[model samples]
Target: MSNVLPRAAALAAAALLATTGALVGATQSSALPMAPTCRVADLELAVGGPQRAGGAIDYPILFTNTTGHNCALRGYPGVSVTDARHRQIGTSAIRTGEPISTVLVAPDETVTAVMRTNSRSVAPNCRPKSTYVKVYPPNSGVAEEISYALRVCGMFEISPVEAAD
Candidate 1:
């Protein structure tokens, strides 16, 4: 009976230590630094219905540049679509206007840019897939953007979804 008490106490202590260690690991993994604010502005992406390959779909990108200083509308950040295996199957780029002009969104200005997806190039089947949208400096990686990065990060369906549906 005397020996049993010491053994049970040691087991309890070990169990407590294991629990604490797991909690610490979880906290550390969840700590991601927040994105820095380049200006007081908000930007969003809206995708219309999906069209088949070699077809066209209207995509509207909306942004409100609210800072007093004018900001340059460089280019598309980075757009990608991944398959079930998490492999990147499609990469998208921003197609600017004919003259490829730079947008200078003045303070408190709201802007909307409309672009058509080159379905043949970006999406073939136009099926539902995971899409990521990012906004960064022109000719820069999404991760390299010091200011902010916008990522959709999940299921995004191209217009029509399917011809049957």
Candidate 2:
């Protein structure tokens, strides 16, 4: 019945409770399901206004989750130039130095991948103009036709999908 015994017991009980909580949290999170890969049909693609800097044009391509559920996007989105008829004009885009990782996209949330190309002002022929840009979301065979009239210059460097912010 001493005060020392009661204090020691209380501390031990607190420690046990904390340890139990940590284990329970870990187990529950491990049991949680992960989002499936994003399908091209469920994503809405949009291109932001182009910004020119350092003789390079960076196009921010946005992929928004149009569905109510969550999905994931990993790696670089295949980007290529196209004409009015949706013909691929050049080789697929080369991956830039951006680290490739999976991005969990919530419903109505947007992720972005920046396409960088040499500015037409630097060399018109080197950066031929394209009437449209065909973007294939990571791991998607189907492509989306986005109105991207620009001098994309044969699929320039592009980064992997990341948070739009």
Candidate 3:
């Protein structure tokens, strides 16, 4: 009976130490600062070229971080073709790429993604040119408007943001 009591006491002490260690670990992790997400106000977007290939026209969507601190971008930017009045003219861009991986942008750094639009042959009804391309950075509610000449039949796709090299 004496030996049994000591063994049980030891087991109880071990469990208490494990619980305390787990709590300390959780606390440390929670206290670490999380990276900030990129916002439209912190970015300057540029749309490059009509690199035509096959039945599609591709453009490089470049995002520059103009903020003073580092920020992260993940997934795809919300893209839409907008008319002069800023109303959506066609379907928003659908994401295309491998699973989302976070891309960190330092001050004055740039990141890029591809924006693809189908040719008129594929989307014959894609008439009524768009006057602006509205872009929303990933994980941000704010949007930036960029003036561009994009004709759409409601078909648009955007690849996930990645490090620009």
Candidate 4:
């Protein structure tokens, strides 16, 4: 009976540790493996909602997980404006915000990064306007192209990936 009690206590302690690790969202790989980083091919990308207000054109670049398994995303996605011929039109988007958290995306779930850019009224001649936004998902070498129609100028800033509410 004494031996069984000690073994049970050890098992309970191990379970508690595992649950706590999940709750804290530790970046380090636990004994249980963490979800792999999301791949570009595993996602459906879209440039959504260019909400123009005042002097700014604001929008969200959305990433939808298409796979059945959960995947992880951290840090900023690489973003650049590209022309119809798939040539990069300008410098890559600058990242804004701090303290990004890892997001575990489940099947069909979406995450977004808000973008802010100059309005047409704010920058008149950034013309031959960009036709699309090129996206490289975090840690991915491959890219995804999404439709975008905007004349981007000045500092184009993007926030970190966040879970869609």
Candidate 5:
């Protein structure tokens, strides 16, 4: 009987320690901070310029977070060149370059994605003319329009979004 009591007490103590450790881990995990994702409504979008890069015309698309909170962005922004009547002038921008990881943008911070077009070199099959570029931020439905003199082939190549500064 004496031996049974000692063994049972040891088992109870071990179980208690295990339960305590699990609780501590759960508490720590729950305390970790999390930021919200950036939305189209919380951002201001602009096109920098039609800079010439080698054989392609590179347009630096800038996104500025206007909200006061930090937000996260990942992947590519949807881009399409549009005519004066808002008609799509070409195929939407396709993702290019290496895969990008999630980027956090603090309040008033900016991020950029380069849109490269070989409109001047594309075959005549690609009818390329546009008065504006419509941009959709990652994971957003609301699009922002940027007016710029852009000529693109029926296809667009877009680099992944990266930190501007």
Candidate 6:
């Protein structure tokens, strides 16, 4: 009985150690991998608007490529809007696949992404939402890139529905 007890304890300890090792190995292997050699630098966001009916909100995002190696920005950079209470109210998927839309920024050049929101409605929720833009490396999901806020506000001002006739 005494020998059996020692053997059982040893087996349990070995099982525990093996389990722990597996867990650690899994965690280390499944980490959110580091970004590719490319990165976003000098990211800036500016919002302009409050124009009349059918006008547009000009949300120009500017950023520089500080890295020595050239990098390409693909598609329209993702833009997200947050309200006064810091709640994300809306998202603008404004990347049009226009020619020259996504291009490589050389070592020190600047890249600009212009996003336009059509002011076709004046719904309160869509009325001048305080917003910011975050740029991610091309094809990198929204989760990967750090966000940078715009200095200005986005006012999607449209005449009331009745006025649109």
Best by TM-score: 4
Q: What's the TM-score of every candidate structure? A: 0.39, 0.76, 0.74, 0.78, 0.73, 0.46
Taking the tens digit of each residue's C-alpha lDDT, what string does model 4 give over 23-142?
333455433346889999889999888888788888888999999998988888889888989999878889886568888888999999878887767876564688888888877899
Clashing pairs in model 4, backbone N/Cα/C closer than 3 A:
none
Better of 3 and 4 by TM-score: 4
Question: How close to the true structure is residue 10 of candidate 6, measured as C-alpha lDDT?
Answer: 80
Q: How well is each residue in 1-165 modelled by candidate 6, as lDDT tens digits?
A: 779998998888779778764333347434333233334432222333333435555444555567666665554455555555555555544445455334555566665555555544432234343544434544556422224343232442111001010
lDDT of 5: 0.80
Distance from true location, Cα of 121 in model 5, Å:
5.6
Model 2: per-residue Cα lDDT over 97-139, one tens digit each:
7788888899999999999887767646664467888899998
lDDT of 6: 0.45
Candidate with the larger TM-score of 4 and 6: 4
lDDT of 1 by residue, 1-165 (tens): 999999998887778778754332346434333333333133323333333434444454445555555555544434444444544544554344333334555556555444345443454544343433333333344322112122222223221111111
The whole-model C-alpha lDDT of candidate 3 against the native structure comes to 0.83
Clashing pairs in 5: none
Show model 3 residue runs off by greater than 4 Å.
1-34
Cα deviation in Å at residue 41, candidate 5?
0.9
Runs of candidate 5 exceeding 4 Å displacement: 1-33, 119-126
lDDT for 71 in candidate 3 is: 87
- Report how far residue 96 has shifted in candidate 6, in Å: 3.9
Range of the 10 consecutive residues with the lowest summed lDDT in candidate 1: 156-165
Error of 5 at 125 (Å): 6.3
